[model samples]
Target: MSQTDSYDDTYTESQVIMTTVKIIAPFTLTYGMFMSLHGADTPGGSFQGGAIIGVTVLMLAFAFGIEPTRQWLKNSFVVGLVTGGVTIFIATGLATMALGGSFLEYDAFSETFGIAHYWGMEAIEVGGVALIVAGVVITLFFATAAGFTPERNRREDEPLEGVSDDD
Candidate 1:
């Protein structure tokens, strides 16, 4: 294919929209980070931060195409992100357990390790959340658009014994 054909093939966005998202995306991402960071100190927290980050990736997917995005975001990365996030969150609780404390006792971690409670909470917020949000969001966004066949199959999709197609 020629250069013109290549341009046609790409899932290119309009200039105006592209520029607008470009301008807005950074702030959106920053806000997401802020959500995670501020969760312990303020109203926001891990889950919300994760969702925002996920939405940011979804927006990028909207801006580009699934295939191209998939090219950059491999399965390993997605799995790693999710698994790593879970590990971070769980490990915090586990560490406390190991230290003979209750689950997710940030104060325990602080007292044991001579670290601040806020820092531990931030770890839970940023590490646990950011990865989980990014992984799940990106995975779901791509999976939903992957065009896979339903699990029900032809037999399951067929009408019930008493039901008619017309009915």
Candidate 2:
């Protein structure tokens, strides 16, 4: 069976890459979480936090190896990335329409959920952030991995008829 690696393994064996990735991942994860949990109370929120998590994933892939990272990349992941954002956006819009207000009226959610408008808006904003982070991070990791692999390289010089370059 082929073993998959973690995103942090991009720099796996190298001492510098390993050390930096190790240190950065924890810090970024913590910071991201902090931002996410207190999104309503601060400048940073779930989106920023999600991006932080995404960054950690990217660093892990760099520190560890790509083979390990494949496990995290799933069909659901692609769907989730797009769906999460769209879900939040659509929900917000629908809420506004139902409430007879603008497209993203926070008043609708606030009233529906029995929360303050500020809170509703914050939730919507944060959710949007989450989707953005997921999509970006996943896409970036795949791109990075491709950059290092031979198969990822679309060499125009290679002959289509199985002819050798030296021929």
Judged by lDDT, which candidate is best? 1
lDDT of each: 0.78, 0.71
Task: Give the TM-score of each candidate.
Answer: 0.74, 0.68
lDDT of 1 at 75: 86
What TM-score, to 2 decimals, does candidate 1 have? 0.74
List runs of model 2 lying over 4 Å from the truth: 1-12, 15-24, 111-113, 148-167
- Candidate 2 matches the true fold with a TM-score of 0.68
Cα shift from native, residue 27, model 2 (Å): 3.6
Q: What is the lDDT of residue 111 in candidate 1?
A: 78
lDDT per residue as tens, model 1, 14-114: 77766777888899888888887777777867678878887887776677666877887778988999999999999988888887678988788777888
Q: Write the per-residue lDDT of candidate 2 for residues 19-128, one digit (tens) a residue.
A: 88888788888887788767678887777777887777777776677656666666477568768877887887777888877887878766667777786566566677
Where does candidate 2 have its weakest 10-residue lDDT segment? 1-10
Off by over 4 Å in 1: 1-12, 150-167
